[model samples]
Target chain A: MSNLIKLNGHTASVAEDEWLLVSLPASEAEERKQAGKVVLFKLTGENTVTNKQIANTVIPTTGKVIVPLSVFIARKAVLQARISKGEIGVWLSTHEVLEHLIKSQPDLNGLPMMAIHVERFADGRIFSLGTLLRTRYGYQNELRAFGDVLRDQLYFLKRSGFTSFQIRADRSAEDALASLNDFSVPYQGAVDEPQPVFQRYNRAV
Target chain B: MYKYDEIDQTIVDERVAQYRDQTRRFLAGELTEDEFRPLRLQNGLYIQRYAPMLRIAVPYGMLSSKQLHKLGDIASKYDKGYGHFSTRQNLQLNWPTVEDSPDILAELATVEMHAIQTSGNCIRNITTDQFAGVAPDEIIDPRAIAEILRQWSTFHPEFALLPRKFKIAVSGTKHDRAVVQAHDIGMEFYTDAQGKMAIRVWVGGGLGRTPILGSVIREHLEWQHALTYCEAIIRVYNLHGRRDNIYKARVKILVKALGIDEFKKQVEAEWAHLKGAPNTITETELTRVSQHFETMPYETLPRHDAGFDTTLVSNPAFAAWVKRCVHPHKMAGYRAVTLSLKPHGKAPGDASSKQMWAVADLAEQYSFAELRVSHEQNLILADVKLADLFALWEKARANGLATPNIGLLTDIICCPGGDFCSLANAKSIPIAEAIQMQFDNLDYLHDIGDIEINISGCMNGCGHHSVGHIGILGVDKDSSEWYQVSIGGKQGNDASLGTVIGPSFAAEEMPRVIQKLIDVYIAERMPEEHFIDTVRRLGIAPFKANVYTKEGAAA
Candidate 1:
């Protein structure tokens, strides 16, 4: 198993990942074998075609699978029975709004896992999205921030409310894990520490 | 003069260590140029025409004598023997090697100074009125709030990689000396109905290729919401600012595209969640930051120093210099002095190492050991006593700092254009020098008084030409250096952009073209009216007709 995974503030092997991502780039998926459960990202490329396919996709209930919200909403009846059994998880791209999923499935907040894709390391849309998922939507499960996850961005991602980071296949998890403590001190309120340094100064006094 | 506490000092020190490692990895080929570009830029290192230019942040333009001495030391040791003060109230060293920049930052850290966020897409140094505390028409001092912003924007996690660079300026008082509307997020401080400090927020105003004035979104936001409101704005900007085109990436374009109302709605929506969150300003921290800017050890002096007045009367040059360079201080018997950087032949704002050290010594001796770098690129001694003004003038003249033409046409605000900048389409320093030479007659310049001639290398607007009374923009025409002239721009409560006269002019004709414009102004201007006022009264039509003769700019 590949040892390029960082979960719960510790470096881990790929075997420890609960769900294998289905629609990762060929290079990333080929580098590691999937854990038995997989998050199917079938509608992944060429936006219009993928989106249309998602609209007409047949939800596969073969074993356990995490569904993209787009796929889940279009084919909710196919896996509606499985969600209560704690079998269905929801996945979202950082840019995808979660309000629709919450509207479609009231129990979406109680799902065991939610994964968000970061399109690029430099793109910070996921930071706000992850915060909203946790704070606004009350998502209290495995919050995964995957894709383009790298060393320099680890601390910010962790503070921005991602519980696990799937290191981009070519990067080392050991190096990325060390960056989580890049800043031990705080200045402003963030997802992980809501009390800015000013409040901390108050409590200290 | 907000001194860095232990926490502040530690963070800057750690940043120095972090940047040093990043630089090491880039040099070792572990990182590509693209990967290292943003990294170095966040630390204020830019690749310029000849070598690496490291921009050092002077937060709110406040500098102590010790800090100025350290800057002089760094300029001498790391680069050449000179440094350039930019229009943003920061210092730019134009010749440091990439390998030597880490050491320069490390040394800067010793003086509670760093180049962090000076040039990156992140929020830059927070600027305010250089005369914030000492100006005669002052409200509350903005140092505390500016310091708060300086800390909050430093090493911010989410906004670090925004689509374009962001600038924030706090206009401390009723007078818009900070040029509020020319910044990305400009704020003005005022007292509320409840006697609490409040701020007026202006989003999306900037001076790049597309110069646009800002609109007020929140006219009565309490000062406590400065952080939360700013956070909301940046968050909204971060998520939606267009990254497709580099030029359309500034918040100004975003605000323009969304329309000010819609943009304000989005920011307000985002702020609803962050409004009273833990990031809101508190009185405890305010008190802490305020103490650093508390009244200095000022001695009570007589209303007038008779000896100084006698000296001022006896020396006509001293009298003229006092009239121009000396500004009234809110503190009795004290004055604020501007040491002009726009002398006749020198590149405006370029100070040699010796000049830097001499100014630092003057700051130590005359101005409460504090100096300010104005956005106009001049150094300020903000707390000199009137009794000492004559002695200070003598020393300043000896050091080549007292030019006695503060508001005159010769006092030009110019960028290090084609001479030092790679992005410049044409040379701006030579244009400035030629104009200064042509207008070398101080008597004539004073007669035509209070003109702002701002020159920029290109549309990046580093020299803030868009708001100058007379704006000169360097443009490339058929691979040759040409200049475009504009008039009627002004920076005050009624700030407005300039209008281009006609066509572009060749380099050699710049001085003569400026001379012709001045001649028209002299012939037609109302008595004692400023150039901007005259331009506003007569409009650009007359100036255009007079400037573009058959053999002049039209040629």
Candidate 2:
């Protein structure tokens, strides 16, 4: 059975009955996950023993395991373990990491998932990166935005193809949600609304 | 002159209500100052050094008698009984309280005016020739297109939070009286070989810390594609323009960084998606807007008025005023008169409430109840009959609007510097006043002939010092005010940025330095040559030597 598990204040669905094994902090994984939610393992460093453990614990079914890109790149055996189990998802902090992954793992084109970390001041850069990633690299997974999300900037953030935002805990979620509808009309193209206002108006006319 | 219909009226009315609510929330502590600053600025309210300065947009500088009277009334009621006409052809009330801005805006809306997109990062008030429809050299009336652009840019959701402020100017005449080259986007209208009206579009031109003339991105764009093309350009800018640095965020910087060719290619790529869109203006809509700017009901008269000729010969003062202030009109007996605001020892553009009322009365009595605010911070009665020159001059003189120094040394273009603006490095009005005092003689000014002295308090170039024939910019050195002089700049058809001469001068020494520069021009000027031509021929070398010489500096 699949169940929702919280990791570092973010919620993700995990398949425990399947062969998914998440590589994150063990304490956070244990406290946030229900019994038999998923396999939780700590990635202290890149070693053959951890990879062997990961390889032995896998069950053959379609599932996803979330792990940082550093651990995935360090241990090729661990990557093979995740690949043999099901799909592999990686958390990214910068464009450098994404570039390195693309160059290193060409066969993981349709197999790998991407989640981008965004800063408040780096919206323009992240937006541009998201555009190139989708249009040029054929990245189809739902892109996630993390870190210091403000309500006023949600409209622009969402327009840039970020499907999920890890909003700050102190902020009001309702206010942030309402901000998505603050502007009834937009003047340019975006992921949520691809047609510019002029095109829509012309079609109506 | 485009009358507001129900839709237009609703747009402005809703904006006013929205701003009023914003003000309420701000006062109740629901919004922080940081949150409320951009909202207020978008509505044309700026918290200045002394008080909140509210800028009221006078679209294309056109005004009716009733609107003029309403402005005067607002000046008396909400301001300090006066208003300053800005170089952008808008009016600024320098003493309004921030809380009172909503009330003032509501009052403005009653007269079919609203202060939308005046001061924020979005598109600003569209400007054009003061004598737009009536200029003799006009090939196509630009006001209609300007009005269309105004409507399209207002309350634009995506562009509201652009990287920086944007400005657009249009010119209908070949002479470039609208200073198109100094705007972010400059559109010049012309008839192509097919007898169809087309536009030449220039992008990335602006005056600020870095002054660059706009480069032509589209040499010939059909009139139908005007709005859509503009949308493409702005969208490209909004998505890709630099946001990390405020100083490097203007479209000019982006255009320069990308090169005009690459920028044009990018704009073309973006425009490919927007071509033939609904925003493309139709002939019916064009006619609907153009009809509002049709020629006034001008009475037919003889080409040569005997009384006008006689008045020129009989009254010296009237002739001088006519010579300096009157501009040619397309009609035979009609003339456009510039009412100079740069009288001796006064702020360049300040007009008292009584003077505003007097101009309104004059407009109602003559000139078909119309007035214009020129980009040089002067008022224009654009359709005055030639026969009424003497009477209009007398009334204008009485109202302190007739300085007879139009296009002369004393007719300065100055920004309200440290006195009002919080961003100013030094005071500018006193510099203008000192120079005006030194050259107060009208005959001497007329002899100097067409010397433009533009002054700005800072490098923001609000006074357009970059294009002044003799530009003066204020600089701060260790917290003390100093002035720098630049020579040989000109605005108009062949716009050029001025070249700054050597080191800075003290405030008290500016008048002396300017006098020395004028002396150099007098000594070297050929017969019938204007000040700008003389400076252009001689270059800044002679003037620099003359000003820096010990004897010249002491004088």
Candidate 1: pairs in clash: none
Q: Give me the candidate number with maximum TM-score.
A: 1
Positional deviation of residue B32's Cα in model 2 after best superposition, in angstroms: 2.3
How far out, in Å, is residue B375 in model 2? 1.0
Clashes of 2: 0
- State the lDDT of candidate 1 residue by residue for A1-205, as single tens digits: 4534545444433435556453422222222123432322221222222455575444454545677777777776877677777677777775566667788876646677777877666767777777777766777777777777776776677777777778888767765666676666767777778777778765221
Tens digits of lDDT, candidate 1, B1-555: 788767777888888877887788789986678778888998899898887789999999999999999999999998788999988899999999999988999899999999989987889999989898998888778889999898888777767678799999998777889999988999999888898888989889888799999889899899988998998999888877866566878999989988999999989998998889888989888888888898878889887999998998899999999999999888889999999998898899989888899999999998889999999999999999999998989998998999999989988999999988888998999999999999898888788888999999999999999999999999999999999999988887799999999899999999999988888888888777777888999999889988877663553
What C-alpha lDDT, on a 0 to 100 scale, does residue A143 get in candidate 2? 60
Say what the interface RMSD of candidate 2 is: 11.7
Tens-digit lDDT track for model 2 on B1-555? 788766566667777877887798789886678767777888899989999899999988888888889999999999889999999999999999988999999999998998887897778999999989999899999999998788777765446567789999999897999999899999999999999999999999999889889999999999988888997898778766766567777999989988999999989987886787667877766777788888999999778899999989998999899889999999999999999999999999999988899999999887888899999999999999999988988999999999898889988999889999998999999999999999988889888998899999999999999999999999999999999999888888888899999999999999999999999989999999988898788788999999999963554
